[model samples]
Structure formats: C-alpha cells, structure tokens
Target: MSDIEDKKNSLIEKMGSEIITLAHGSGGKAMQKLIDQVILGFFGQPNQGPLEDQAIFDLSAYPNHSIALTTDSYVVTPLQFPGSSIGHLAVNGTVNDISVSGAIPLYLTCGLILEEGLLFKELIEVIADMAEAAEQAKVKIVTGDTKVVDRGSCDKLFINTAGVGVVNNSLNIRIPNIEVGDKVIINGDIGDHGVAILAARGELDLQTTITSDCQPLNGLIQTLLAEGIPIKAMRDVTRGGLATVLNEYAQGVNLGVLIQEAQIPMKTEVRGVCEVLGLDPLYLANEGKLAAVVPAEYADKAVEIMSKHPAGQNSCIVAEIVEDHAGRVVMQSDFGGKRVVDMLVGEQLPRIC
Candidate 1:
C-alpha cells in the first residue's frame, strides 16, 4: 500500500472507526453511543455528558447570570428552494428552537461543510442569505469553521450552527406544564417546508410556487409573551412535522390531544402537493412555525396577540388537551370521523430539515 493509505489506515485503527453511519443521526441509543464515544469524548466535558436539547450552564455563578446553549446542523437537499434557502433555514431553525425555550438568541457559530467542485458563487449566495437572516433574527455569527471534502465525499453543502441565548426573566416554559383543557395553536399553515422541497426537486408536478415557511419566530413568541399570555409549552414543528411534535408533548404529559381538521390551516398548494404525492400533511416538515399550548382562558388572547404578528397572522387554535386516550393524538376528520395520529416510525423524506 501507498504511504498515505497506510497512514490513513493507522489513523482509522487508532480512532476505532473507519466510516460514519446513519445511527449518528438517530436520537436513540446508537446516536448516544456515537456522541459519547466519538463526539463527546473528543470535545465534551463531564458537565455536558447528559445531553439535553440545549446545554444549561450556571452563568449566574460566573457573574453573567444564566445562559442556554444550543447547536444544530442543516442538511436539507437543494439548498435553494422556494421562499427560503438552507442558509436562512439554518438560522431560523436554530433561533426559533432557542427562542421557544424563553431565551433571546444572542450569538451564533457557523460551520460549513463544502464539497469539492461545488460552485463558489453558490457558496457565496448561501452565506449571504445566512448573514441576512441572522441580521433579521438579531443574532450575530461570531465564529465559524470551514472544511472541504473530496468530491462525492460530501453533499454540495451542509451547515452546522451553535447559538447562545439569554433566558428571559418573565417566561417559564416547560413540557410538563401542558395540561388537560390546554389549547393547542399553530402559528401558520403546516407542511410548507416539505412541500416546497418536494416541488423544488420535481417530485411533484404541481406548477404553483409553494415556498418554504422558513423564518425566525423569536419576534412572534416575544410578542405573545409580552402580552402576558400564559404559554405552557412551545415547540417549533420541524422534522417529523406536527404529528410527531404533538405525540411527543402528549407522551411527556401523559395526556390526550384532540385536533380539528377544519381548524388546522394549510395552504391550498401545499395540500394539493401532499394529496398528489400520497403524503400526510401532518408528517411533513415545517421550519418557521411553532405549536404552542396554553390554558383555555388565555387561548383567545394568545390568538389575538399572535394574529397581530406577521409570522402568526394565520395562527389558529387547532387542538386541545384531553384526559381521554392518554398519550395519544386524536384528530377529528373533516368527514366527522376521529382518527389517531401517531409518531412517524421511519423517515418519510430523508435529508429534509
């Protein structure tokens, strides 16, 4: 073997692995193993071993108060799609996730993975879009890393971002707060991101432009919180879509949820694409939107406050928490039939953000 090949083999042996696998993306035990053995072993600390969605550090002891840190990676195919691109999606996704936790996103670290032979112009455009989105979200990209892989070793481009945000004093959002009789509301139409990606890839024949619903939702959430709306829990509907998100909340609270088919807002184009593709809109992805649970008394007021914001203008009360059928998501069909919506067992669309 050549000297380079021998050296690469030696390095792989030392690392005890030669290639990556899909388990790295799974959120299950295999994913945890990969993180603990490879990722965390290399860079994580003892305090950060128990992985939560975001890292919580006691900044109060350090004189700066408390802080929340989160990181995410974007691997959506066809970086440029209708309404938004991977760049903006990355920023919005990270910012919204942090914001829903009652934090004000402050700074971001960007990491770019570029494939050899990828066009430089395209890369510039993506970065420019990311910069603009970050500006709108009121977050700064403070640091970053760049790496290029050989042709065929990587996708055209992928982005990883880590964000730091300060927790707001007045808000206390948590999953356990979701209770029976709590109203479930969505910021806007669902499934826009998935449909947009599908259409962009020519997977659907529909000609109409159904752009992605990708945008920073921090402003909308802040507006609601400012109005003193009591939010029990809030989560952005991204991968696995609304169905998976609701199922998670229901399971966490050991409660049942009932959603109205007529009340859920969805664009005609998106609905059409889903119908043609034999896809369930509920399982499709959305990047810019969120689902919030609030008490019945605060529901109307919350919807009013949400409607005033552009991002939440189309917001509607889609469902309600119930004591019956604990840990299940039941939907009232348009035909007056009740159906159960469960978590997505497998990937409906791979590499979809």
Candidate 2:
C-alpha cells in the first residue's frame, strides 16, 4: 500500500475505540479519518477526486419540464435497523414526497449532522446504505454537507435531503380534484415503519421479525400514472399513518370518509405489537406505503396496476369518500361497530423519520 494508505490505516488502528470522539469533529486528522473512512468511502465522487461545496445540474436537457422541489429531515435513532438506515430513510422520504406530487425524482442534496461518540462503523454503514437506496430510486445525490457536533448535542446522526423532480403537467393530480364517491386505496401494510423503530429501541423488550417498510414509492406511483389511472389525491402513509391522511383529505374537501377495518391491510406481527401495546395501528406511521383517492370506477384498475409491482403487491381499497358527515373520518370495525378515526393528539413514535 502507499505511504498515505498505510498512515490512514495506522490512524484507525491507533484510535483504540470504534466510537467517535471530539477530535473527529475538530477539523483535524481525526476528522479527516472520519470523512475518509465513513462518508467519502461510501459515496465517492464520480468525475472528480474530491467533493465540492455545490453541485450543478443542466436542466436544459429536458425542454419544457416542470420541476418539483422538496426537502425532508430524518432523525431515526438506531441509525442502522432491521431493514433500513437513517440515510436510506432520508433519500426515500424525499423522493416519495416529490413522487406523490406527480413528479419523477431526478436529483438530491444531502446534509448530515453527526454526534461525537458515535461509532465510525455505523456511520459508514449508513452512508453506504443510502447510496444503494438512491441508486434503486434512480436518483443521484449530486451534492451534500456534513457537520459533527459534541456528544449529546445531537442524536447519533441525522440526515436532511432536498430533492428535485420533473413533473408531467398533463396529469395535474391534486387534492382539490377529489370528488364525492371517490375510493381510497393504500399501497401496502401500515404501521411497519413505526413499529420497526419502536422495536429497534428495545424499550418494550419485544421480539418479532417485523422490519421497517421504508422504501421508495415513486416507481409504484409511476406505474399507476403510466397505466392512465385517474388519481384525485395521493398521500404517503408516514408520520400519522392512514388515519391522519384520511383526516387530511376529508377536512380538505369538507367531506366525510368511511373506512372498513376488515379491508385495511396490516402485517400480522404489526397488529400483534399494537394489540400488546394498546396502540391503535391506524394512527401509527408507515414509510414505504401510500394512500390514494381515485375515482370509484378506476379504484379496481388502480389496485390492479399497483399489485403488478412488487412494492405495491398488497394494495387494497380501504375507504370511500362520502358527503353526509362532512369533514370527519369514521371507521367500521369488523364486529360491526363504528368509531371516529380522529387525528392523533401527539406523535405515536418520535424520530421515526
């Protein structure tokens, strides 16, 4: 190996501990070690030898393109989890946002905040996982920033992503376009993301095989659009899960929504976790799923088109828009009882995304 390579490895060996230190954030050799062994090693510059402060894109390649811009932050603890990492969540979270707005995600910019005393190995794994996710979503992380703070000042790590996409103006899907008699369909099981994070914390001392369903939904949504399915509104089931999304649509349109408990899809393990914790799955969070409002006639077609894709194989119709009880969402239990699915008073799982 070259003298510099031997020296870098020697530095890593002499660190003694796998955890980060104040020196790693001091803009010195230790900091360079952290950057070389963690960040740049995973997300390497393609055409340049080193990273620059900014990235330039040539939008002129796409003539008459409508652009969509979105930014999101992810602060999930246990940066590495069963199915995803904070980096993976950051990319998918931003891409999904632009996708729901009827746009094709193109590029992204990432900003990371690292806390001292975190494991250098963990940071490396997070960035590598993120690179894989961006590749899968067909988006590029063209620019990024990183900052390290003293221990306890921040979580182990937090990621912020700003995404840009090209929107097809011909579709023009928006919430206001929702009409009475519209049907609500969800892409997959709910509560997986929240429950996964909860389980990773190990506070509940529960053991199950449930992993976070954190993934990019743009591909599935694009399939629906390509099939010419009529969509009125679409919301990814995230922070407040299905109930919160339903409430948003109902209140936005000043209409009522009725959902069937039996029809709502959820993983068996997720349901069991909620039952034991006395938490309502409807109010939980999801990462890789979405709920959409489509015309009644096109609901079945939408489900069919979505089912053909692996990401949306479990898509199903769960609710319908009604005019009677305007601005409210009611759920019918499988036992034939009805109750209001109200907005959550507070977050069920903080730092989930």
Candidate 3:
C-alpha cells in the first residue's frame, strides 16, 4: 500500500466517533474507509477481492446461471425533480447497480418512508412513476413496505430498493478483470441529474432547460452484453459521479486511469450550473449514466454498441487504463496538463441520489 493509504488507515483507526457525518454517506473516500474499518472489519478479515456493486452467487444446480443482487436508497430532496421522481430514481438506481454487474434484473422490492404530512396525491404520483419506470426496465416490483413517521421526523419521502437479477454463467466480468490498455466508455452525459436536481430546488434562482438524466439502464446494458464486447467491468456513476467511479476502478485494479477532459461527455447546461455554483461536474452525481471498462480492441465496438440504445446515444470513449501511477485517476486537460482526480472530500450536493 502507498504511504497515503497507510496514513488514511491509521487515521481511521485513531479517530473516535460514534456519530456519522454527511461525508460518511457521500459514497466517497471517507465513506469507503468507514465501511472498511467499521462495517466490513467487524465481520472479520474481509474478502481480499475486487469490490463490485453487486454481490454475485453461484447456483450449482443451474450450471448456466448465477444471481446478482444489489440495493440502493434514494433521498434526493424535492422528491419530484425535473425528469424523475424519488420513486423512479429508486427503481432505476437499484436496477442499474445490478445491471452494471452483467446481470439481467428480474425483480425489485421497495421500502418507502413517508413523512406524516406528505400529500397522498404526491405519494400516488411517485408510485405511479415507479410503476412506469419498472415497466420500462422490464423488471417487476415483486414486494414492498411502507411506513409513516411524524411530520418532522423525516423528509417528505425516502425510497429504498433491493434488486435481484440473473447473471449469465458465461460472464465473468469483475474489477480485477480491468487491466492496462483497457479503454473506459461512458454511456451518455455526466452531471445532468445532479445539476437538474439542484436547479429544481430553486435555491440559486438559476434558469435552464436541463433535466435529470434519470432512466433505467438495464435494456441498454443488455444490448451491450448481447454484443459480447469483452467488457471487463461496469459502473453506474451515481452518488459520486464519473470521478468516483473511475477512482474506484483504479483502486480496485491497482492501476492508473487517464481520462481526457475534452472527451468527457457533459451538457452545457450542467457545466453552466456547476460554474455558477462553484461545483465540479466530475464530483457531481448522475443517475442514468454508466461507465464501462473493456479491452482496447473492443473499445470502439463498446461505444458503438451503447450508442445504438436510446439511453446510451451520447456514449463516448472517455479514458484508458495505464500501468503508471497505480491506484490513481489522472485527468488530462485541453492545455496538455494533467492532475489527479481524487474522490470528494466531503458531501457535494447532499441528498443527491
């Protein structure tokens, strides 16, 4: 391990805290350390394996099949956003988490936390959105739970979703599968969902046509998988955006990821919002976008495959893996300069799904 990593682990061990900070839920470096030292460590020597978004299990009797399961919670403020509701976000987020693991999402279970004063009409709309999204993704909401808290006990609503999917036995995609010479592909633009959610809050009185790029990606992922494009691994850029996803991939494989700033897909509106609010799009969140790592030989094919899908029409090759600077992400600027793109230090746009 690098000295920086050692120091981080030492700090985590030395710190005394029974309380959780928003950063602990930011899905960034601090959260990772918290999980490693507190959650996973408590379970005894954690598995020394490349981390994946979904847990995979084998079915011995069904030799041609395995299972992938993942869970996610959405608490994006303003429950109803420009392009999606919390309900839709919950279903799509959980489904994408499983889909990125090369799984075919089959079913989902939702748990809703409702504030007492929340309107039933609003609740109906959120559920309706979820139903449409589930149908669009070709996944079923097989089970669920609902609970109400005191008026001020919780926010308007929060949705938790757990998803189960079938993984093809032939697919062995994992983070460890990523290696030097691999190319990174992103499906669609980044930062749209985060910026759109912020705009919906009307805190800055910013006006723009940007809408959340929130949509289920199982169909798009299935299309890419069908092409047999030699995908090494995939990730949905959710809580911590493209930078976080690339950082995780680099750390997992102990390699460097070099991405070009000019090549990253971003909407002008998102860029504008970040500029006005002093936010970096790299560290923002995204709901509908995903990043895929594939062999150099399959890079173009991967982009082509994704571009053919509605959810992936804005796809592009964003980066490549390198052997130098192990466990770091380097972003090459248009001016021929490079800098390390580290994970968020604290929560950026809290409550963003």
Residue-by-residue lDDT tens digits, candidate 2, 290-316: 898999999999998899898998899
Per-model lDDT: 0.79, 0.85, 0.80
Error of 2 at 310 (Å): 1.0
Residue 337 in model 1: shift from native, Å? 1.2
Segments in model 1 whose C-alpha atoms lie over 4 Å from true places: 1-65
Off by over 4 Å in 2: 1-19, 26-33
lDDT of 3 by residue, 268-341 (tens): 87888888889999998989988999999988988888888899988999999999889999999999999999
How would you encode candidate 1's per-residue C-alpha lDDT over 5-92 as one tens digit per residue? 3433443455443333443344567446544443333234344344554433434533433577899999988989989999898899
* Collision pairs in model 3: none
Clashing pairs in 2: none
Candidate 3 — which residues are off by over 4 angstroms?
A: 1-63
lDDT of 2: 0.85
Q: Estimate each model's TM-score.
A: 0.81, 0.92, 0.82
